[model samples]
Target: RDIAPSDVLAAREAGATGVVLEAGATNSHALILARSLGLPAVIAVAGLLSSVTDGDLIEVDGNSGEITIGETVPASAPVAAGRATPSATRSSAPPVTRTTDGRVVRLYANVGQTADVGVALAAGAEGVGVVRTEFLFLDEPPSEQDQYEVYREMADRLAGKPLVIRTLDAGGDKPLPYLPVAPEANPYLGLRGLRLSLAHTEVFRTQLRAILRAAVHGRIMLMYPMVTNAEEIALANEQLLAARTELAASGEEAGDVAVGAMIEVPAAALRAEALARHAAFLSVGTNDLAQYTLAADRNNAAVSYLYSQTHPAVLRLIQATVTGAHRRGRPVAICGEVAGDVDALPLLIGLDVDELSVAPHSLERVRAAIASLSYPECVARTEAHLRDV
Candidate 1:
């Protein structure tokens, strides 16, 4: 059955224990509420509704993202390409973050929603690479205190692991019904990411305040998405300063916060050094980078083949980004689909990605894979393969 947020409440009022929904609605306001309200949910299964009749028994395992129908086990658990279930693969491997050859590569999780934090941590994420804040506000933005309480709970749960929060990245493909968005000739190239946040300064300010307030609970690093140049980062930082000032006047305590910039746009990747000079850290968003560099829309199957993180050009941008960040003593984290990819592990390690953030489900499999690779061999191979003339 379709479970909207209101439906979650209605279902609860009817004394339903949990809800199973079509995978497509995971980002809906209701699904977010389901998790917030402590209701278990399983999403993204084909033939989900059809498979179950009225009052049929189903087991929704939110942790494993699995749904079992009518006491029958699911035929297979979802797994990453060329990988097995994390539990199946865990063979007494050390929980420490390191490779077999002694190179330390931190494994983080790219959490799409707040409920994902538990799964990511349970899967052994050392820190949070990116919390896609956009998923928190599906239908409309939450009030300041609502945002604060939610973020505060996340920070408290983290209990000291680094949390990098990517401020609301909306517009382009992800237009909000509550907020009006103009039709774009190329929405991907138009007002998106920081551009949209800049357009709605008050909303951004509220988020900033919430994040700032939440920082008091544990480590929190604020970051902006889709930043093209230093000016945008500078302007956004200026607003952050205002948020801090407002908090100070309101007698609120915000922990010492660090600022970061996402190097997604080629312009940002190209001039990463200059931006690094102003940022506390930098992250490479390979998903957007690959699409923008290759002129391919990842969502469109026609150009899907071209939407590869392994392409030489995309690799070079990543190389340049990591090299620049390292030169400036700033750690570079990659929070994209590629980070979770087992095939791209060696290249990312070779590129010297300080942190690899992947989907929660793929975290342990990726960790197992990383533990099997040699840092020295990867660096040598990467240097030879991406040799710059």
Candidate 2:
């Protein structure tokens, strides 16, 4: 029998923090559920069960398909030398993602918890890319005041470092039993992300109120996920304005905060200019974009071959997004697996993406890669279809 979303839910309910799936199950519903739950998972691992015995300590890195067993380990995960995390220890501040030719690229980290901030910062993350706020509601959502404190502490911990907080992005692959989430025929193409927020006004508003209140602590940025068009951005902003008004009436006001949109769906990416009109920034969530564009799930090992960021179509959309955002004076940051991908880096640089937000572990190598290559060469190689090396 194949695994289902319920299977992942059961694992989570049973307190399993991660999952290792067979090779063919990469794009399966179970994998989607694992990501939705923020549980670490390594997909399509060859001979996974045969290689492991019960009670053996195992670490699964979803970013890199590396599996480790036993307590003996290296001082750090694999990363290239030169301005690397360990090697960069001589400097007081983390180095920005920059090239050998004196070009600078901003690199941020995607964090789930507050402690993740320090680790990312230590690894040279310029800021926190995207914080999936859905985790705040996994075991019964927190009270508004409770969420405020959690968000406030995160800001305090960052201490002026930038933080991009994505509002609740539940539905489709992720459903909340505590909330009214009806089963759908095609969940991915159905309600989720920003769409879910607008549909569930109260839930969205409460999160906004908390985020707005917490904006006083750091360089906090509000991002709406899976936004498809200009209207959604506008409607979401209306709610935000009301939240601000409510806080004002109570004599406490949230400081200036920049609102942004996630360019994960094609509709948003295509009409980027329209969306940019209202958003202060645009971030591309390439994980969903790749799957949606290719019509193949990354978890489905059978068709996973079709899921590629290198495809010209995907690159075209990315190029279009960056061009549109820059035209409107808004910066675009890529916050997906592709952002951290070494092979995909040059193409991204060619496309002129403004920022890259990756997992903390990828910070060092990505920085090193940037330092190793000149931006002009990356662009020329990509343009001429020549080997980047």
lDDT of 1 by residue, 256-364 (tens): 7899998889988989898999999998888788889999875554466677777878989988888788889999998877776787899889888888877777777
TM agreement with the true structure for every prediction: 0.79, 0.83
So what's the TM-score on candidate 1? Answer: 0.79
Residue pairs of candidate 1 with colliding backbone atoms: 5-30, 23-44
lDDT per residue as tens, model 2, 288-358: 88889999865656787788866777777887899899989999999877777788888788778889987
Clash pairs of candidate 2?
Answer: 23-44, 26-299, 26-300, 27-299, 27-300
The per-residue C-alpha lDDT of model 2 at residue 360 equals: 65
- What C-alpha lDDT values do all the predictions have? 0.78, 0.77
Candidate 2 off by > 4 Å: 1-19, 23-42, 46-53, 56-93, 385-389
